[model samples]
Target: MDAETLPPHVVRTAPGQYEATLPGGTLRMSMRQEELPLPEICDFALRHNARRRFLFVSRVLGRHMPTRPAAMQDVASRLADKISIDPADGPVLFVGMAETATTLAQTVYAAWCRRGGQGLYIESTRRPTGGPIAFEFVESHSHAMAHLVHLPSPEDDPENLFTTARRVVVVDDEATTGRTALGLVASYAAWRGIAPESLRRELAVLARWMTDAQSTESEFTAFHSLVEGSFEFVETGVFAEAPPAVPHPDRAGLARRGTRHGLSHPQPLPWQLDVSPGHRILVIGTGEYGYQPLLLAADLEARGAIAWVQATTRSPVLPGGAIGHVRSFPALSGERHTEFLYNVPEDHGYDRVLLCCEDVLPPLEHPIHHISRLEVLPLPGTLTS
Candidate 1:
């Protein structure tokens, strides 16, 4: 059966009254939905990460035409509240996690920066084809071991961008254990010689879904107070653990379909093509669809194509030199007509450019059109062929 014809239990449900069958007994959730309007909190927690399972499937950012600026603002405002810093407290450095959270983090940074404080936006990325690296680190669960961060020169730093800025807001989609943020704090503290307690660092996310038992909030606080100085976290509602594994007809069918096609059934991307052996292909993704493109790029690499992936987002670029994980590329829209300028020289000269995501479209003036063979990969469920 097609995914759409699957049983109701297989589809995602709205956050409201719902019945779920558990191992020992039945579980139900009955609570009034409360809206949280903190911009930073929303940006970091709600929108930063993409939906992991079938339980949640909506994409919040520019994936749809009407970009929710208010949603972005709500997250930024909450993050500011957590830090207890005035919106005008100079420029704040906003660093986003890799892949999915890049745009969401960038939005929070823009909101924070627009409020009289300069905003410096940086996102983490695993693609290492081009761009100068200012720093590098490792993400435990990621397939890529090395993450490269690119910061602009000090000359490009905005008036408010400074290493000694009172607040450095670290934004992620979700803070499950707060370990990622804590690791970030430890890195900054060690580098600056500021006690974790003395270093004014704040953490924010779109949702604080992970329970305290799963997170290191208490441990982080204790470590900072004992090892350094102080740190704080601002978040929305704590999330409960996802429902235990229930039979998913859609996933199972997809798995079966893959085996028939000689593809790795239900595993990320089944169809992989080697554009050319040893040739590097860059697949750029849109906001919400970033992770899928990254996965496909990796799969293509495994199939013998040197692949690099990056994403374009709606977040405003800050006038600073501090770098984040993902590299900011230009979108094809608007008056500049310089969108193709952001394409990496090493990437543009590739044998193929497999553009993924439903929203990504070729530019009118694509530089690669004349140089390389371009192909489009339609996302599942929406594919006609």
Candidate 2:
């Protein structure tokens, strides 16, 4: 098999240090594994949050960057290959961190299904429900901190999903400090009235990058990933007010529910992007819902156009190092909030740029300059049907 190519901006700076340049700014990342190249898996980006200074933007996540569906599926498949499922390990429960890795985790569960294995897919969300809250945890570094785990209905055997499972496989796009996972396990420990050290866990981590200070208190039998390493974020002392962000955890929850039970909600305005042969296009999905634009990108790709998909985020990051550049825009909700896209280079422009949002329409002027066409279309249910 031929080795795939890494993005041009991915460069090794020094021993255990690599720089990933995106349009936002260059990120100086620290890695523990010399064998795992940074660019092949992910790139570094600065974070805009007051608590954290940087973000490790994923390339295959099909979230921040536009990627093909097949490629995204391949990543999940590859990650699954690294995990060894033993019948002796007993029944397992797969937990996907909300918003970002929900889909990635679902794909992993799908992989298990292929092997005729059984597992219940559980996800952590910021959304609340009238149902009982299984547990709640905070993603301290994220723009939104509160995450709630609501179990499925009793008819689906929610009790069995938790009690019968001997292990919890937590999945996330990448681990920066690993505190998020720690918080998760800690929350789980409290919910079950079990000691944190007593849980049998296996981290099906995507990017297993952890700093020296990261928590490793685990009963996990295995740690698996397509790549493993860490990055160093150097903040420029640049501070600013971010745009108003809507977690829309409800939409994320609905999508997961829809996928499981074949339910579909009202979609945002149905808009079409006219594509021509050999056009390099970009479709941007707003907030936590990237699945819609992902399907759009797939349609564009099937039509012979080189279509790429990415999403807008409320996370604050400083520019420089790994991120080549940063572009800011008025939040879709209004001027009250600010949104950003990183790693866009001045040199590489697209033919068409399409914006898809779940709830609000963003100002269309800032991100893509000199593009032949720019269209702002509200995603299904985000606007008039």
Candidate 3:
């Protein structure tokens, strides 16, 4: 993830302040740019949480942006190629940070499996499953601080995916201070009664922007990423706060659908979307219910459409960095929280942008408000999550 001479992507906006030129617009921010090209991978945004004045928003993570499914697969495959484990290596478990990195982690785990690596994908969630709790950790900066790690037990791990596990690989979008990842591994190590020095552990991310998050001279701990470097964020303490974020979905429908509890494969709803084949299609998942959208994308691809799945997020970011564009509209969750999609093309972004939601159809004027060539296609059935 280290580069020799990447061009600077951040520009000084004002005295002691900077702006990242994202794909969409100039994101006003202040960062002491380090050796890394800050805007190439991500940009800064104001956070609703007062403790953390800014947020390192990613372009390709698809949380605040709409990204192609194949592109995500490409990233996962490329990352899989980088992670190597000898057959003699112990069982591995990949932990994807919930809400943000769940899908990304699953994508990498899927690729890892294709590469003949043995691993189970478990993610930390704010939602409680009422099942066995493996361990827990804290992300102090996140709006949702509490995290639950649900591990598979003897009955679920017939293959000994848990018992034989000696390695832990944590995946995330970006590493700001690296404390979260380090803390997670430390907690897991304590739970297993093993010293952190006893096992192989690595923190993987798309961008290594945090200086503290960078790799140091240690074999016991390592950091890997698609792009690695550092940026300086000089929070002016004058940024506007985003509106309150809706808490993680906990509706009975979403819980039954396993929105929070980790899923090897999201249970598919027996429903379908009708669209033309062979076209480059964009399917938008409303809110955090993205698994269903991915399933829909796979089905569309199988039906001859070059399909990709992306979603609107409750998280608000000042546009820029990989965020070429941002589409702001009311969400279909019936919560009235603002929804956003980043870097979607203007005219030719895609042949069609299908707004997919579980239940509570968006208003008739919603889709046309932000996107053209849009169709409000309801994913059949009373869906929630």
Return the clash pairs for model 3, or none: 1-228, 22-320, 22-321, 23-324, 24-324, 31-232, 32-232, 65-342, 254-385, 278-304
Candidates arranged by lDDT, highest first: 3, 2, 1
TM-score leader: 2
Q: lDDT score of model 1?
A: 0.42
lDDT of 2 at 218: 47
Candidate 3 structure quality by residue, lDDT tens digits, 35-134: 3334444545544565654566654555665555665666666677777867666778778886677667777777787777776667776555567677
Candidate 1 wrong stretches, greater than 4 Å: 1-33, 36-58, 61-84, 87-91, 129-132, 143-145, 158-162, 219-385
For residues 1-385, what per-residue lDDT tens digits would candidate 1 score against the true structure? Answer: 2435422332213433333322122223232322431121211111121222111111233221112334433544555444433554554555667544655555555445445445555555443324344555555433223444554445444452535544566776555466666676666555557776654566666544344356466644221110011112323233345322212111111111111111111124435554566876767554324444555665666667776665554332221111112233343322121122122343346666666644334464644344356676655543331
lDDT of each: 0.42, 0.62, 0.63
Q: Model 1, residue 12: what's the lDDT?
A: 17
Global Cα lDDT for candidate 2: 0.62
Off by over 4 Å in 3: 1-45, 153-156, 210-220, 235-237, 241-254, 257-273, 278-280, 286-292, 298-306, 318-385
Using all chains and alpha carbons, the TM-scores for the candidates as numbered come to: 0.45, 0.72, 0.71
lDDT winner between 1 and 2, please give it: 2
